[model samples]
Target: MPLSTRQSVIIALIVASAYFMENLDATVIATALPHMAATFGVTPVGLSIGMTAYLLAIAVFIPISGWVADRFGQRSVFGGAIVVFTGASVLCGLSNGLVEFTVARILQGVGGAMMVPVGRLAVLRSTEKHHLMRSIAYITWPGLAAPVVGPALGGFISTYFSWRWIFLLNVPIGLLGLALTATFIPNYRASTHRPFDVSGFVLSGVALICLMYGMELVGQLHSDWRITVAALTCGAGAAALAIRHLGRAAHPLIDLSPWRIPTFRVTLDGGSLYVVSVSVSPFLLPLLFQLGFGLNSFAAGLLVLAYAAGNLGMKSVTTPILKRFGYRNVMIVNGLLTAATIAMCSLISPSTPRVLITLVLLIGGLCRSMQFTGINTLAFADVPPARMSSASTFFSMVQQMTIGLGIAFGAIALHAAVLVHGNHAQLSLADFRVAFLLVAVLVLISVLYFIGIEPDAGREVSGHTRTASR
Candidate 1:
């Protein structure tokens, strides 16, 4: 039987809660990493493996999420995912060694890999076309909160309580979500005619894993040349294999034809560059605070709160700005603004006032929000309804991959700065200044991708409003 309106609302809330928790887990470890390292007796690089393991697991399993959701029902996959994720979180907290924690993180990643895409798919399939965007907007609000709230929350728990509490917090929320899903979420099965596309799946997974691993290795540039060369070769070869598989498959996992769309291509190019540049800050800022400026975890967490404030503050106005100026203009101008704000971070120093640093981060966060809003909206604006599912999957995959790469690149930049300045033990105020400047330059270069977009291109603001109203 079809669900009632009340049931649907409950289901949406359940999924949103799960979604928020899943994403929150991804970054909650950042502020707690120092403590986790101390507890595990590992170096920064070794502790970073916790993040790497999670990301690699997610990337490897993402391609199969859609298939699993189709083979089983959405409710089954989503509910089961919540249980697995929650259980894994408990194990992660209980872990006594680095290897054990890494294994638990991978298991958590496996559950997360299923939770998001399937939940989104359920919401999409359940809602009417007119109500679709609104439903998605509601579901996505929790996700926006994750980045804003995660650092502060994680820091408070890790500092006041224990790092274990960070993972333990997921338990109650997951249980509630699971109960809601079991009660309200409907089962959805795949069409019999749709083939699994095994070859495409394998090749695509290999390609993504290699590329992400290669990017991670790039951070260890001082490592053995043989290791670097091997990773690069594997990444390149896997990419070639995926491309070949895409050409031959009857039903390719990702339809590369979308790249042929000029607007789609431009949006992706601009978005990727923008994410790579902006995504690095979250990972870099905490380390800088502790090592460079000698701030405590609580204080550093507050600075991150400022970034979230700017992001949330801009949410209301960002869409309107895109509508008024159109995607091309908004992206081009805002992209520059984002880069300039990040570059301004270079001015940060131990001698710099806290108020000034916070103000700079606030501006950067606002611009980052605008840039992401514009790019994401424009990327999908031209996609036909028939291709929406594939487009969404592809977009999500790229977003995740880029975020991982961004952090890796930031690590590389910081490591290089430390090497150049001959400061090995602790990062200095000067090291952060140089690293921020380098990332800011990279952000500036991203503006070139948006240059391809015409001012008149993309749906107009009035049109979107009219459609929404109807």
Candidate 2:
């Protein structure tokens, strides 16, 4: 049975809620690490083990989320994910020691790995082809709120109240989302039972965990180089094995054959690059304002709110813009604009007017939001119906890798600049300039990928036709 209009909207919102909670939890701890570490009687740096644990849990489990959802059922698995996430959040808040907190976070990461992709599976199954673009836009645009809100909210809560409240606050949101999900999200699953690919799962999990963890280690100033090298080499070996197995396995965990599709390939190769750069901005911007500019956390967060507003404000215009200009053009133009805005950040200083700084960030947010929605919609526009689940899972998994790399890349840039300066002094504005410039150049380079995409490439989803071309 086709889902009704009202039901479809509700379903999209439900997925968005899960995505929000997941993104929020991922970022909120950044601002509160000092306070969190104080309670555990450890240095802030020592508590990075908890962060790494959470990320590792996510890497190990996400590759299987789609298969698990298929095997069990979407609604059941997604609902269970919410329960685990919510319960784990409570545990995180109540944890009294570093070990306890790390364990809780690992549990939370398991929930998170399923939370986004499974919810997405439901949406992709329920929404119609013609309505796909609009439905996706509805779900995605709202979740952008999490990254911006997480930093500000974490800073506010830690400053005014308790850091634990950050975790506790999700309790109510998760419970409400769970109830609504049970009421609305349809129970969709594949009819035939596919044999589980145990080898593929293990190989992929090891590959991702080692690769991401290695990337994180490389970014740390004190990390051992030999360990980083070993982790990266092992990750590469494991990934090669996984790819070989996937090619020969009957019913592999995910089908990389989707890469043959031009849209999917560009999205995977090019879109991943853009995500890495954009992801760095959230981590970089707050540090720029708070550390480099010597602003209080509250003030820095207030400034970041401009970027959030720009992100949200672009939602109303995104669909129409894609319809008007088409994916290739919009992605190329808006992408460059986004890169320019990021480069513009290099020009900001304590002497720069607050209004000017906000304006630059706002424009960057708006452009990046359009680029994100466009790439996502186009990636699926050409995908066959049968492969939707696999495509969604694969894309989401790749996104997780790049998002993790983004923050680490930003950290490495900052630390590298500090090293070059040969100073024990605190991070200066110049270090941030170096970081922003590096990432922005990467973003600029990705624009060339869109040039390879045909002008009419995503026409079905974009509703862009020759007769309507401007």
Cα RMSDs, all models? 3.9, 1.6
TM-score, cand. 2: 0.96
Once superposed on the true structure, which residue ranges of model 1 sit more than 4 Å away at CA? 1-16, 33-47, 97-99, 123-152, 182-189, 220-225, 415-427, 454-470
Candidate 2's clash total is: 0
Candidate 1 lDDT for residue 20: 88
> Largest lDDT belongs to which candidate?
2
Cα deviation at 461, candidate 1, in Å, is: 8.0
Query: Candidate 2 lDDT (Cα, whole model)?
Result: 0.87
What is the lDDT of every predicted structure here?
0.76, 0.87
The true-versus-predicted C-alpha distance at residue 51 of model 2, in Å, is 1.7
Q: Number of backbone collisions per candidate, in order?
A: 0, 0
> Predicted candidate 1: what Cα RMSD to the true structure?
3.9
Q: List model 2 lDDT by residue over 419-462, tens digit each.
A: 87766478888888988999889898889898898988888778
Best by TM-score: 2
Q: For candidate 1, what is the TM-score? A: 0.85
Off by over 4 Å in 2: 419-425
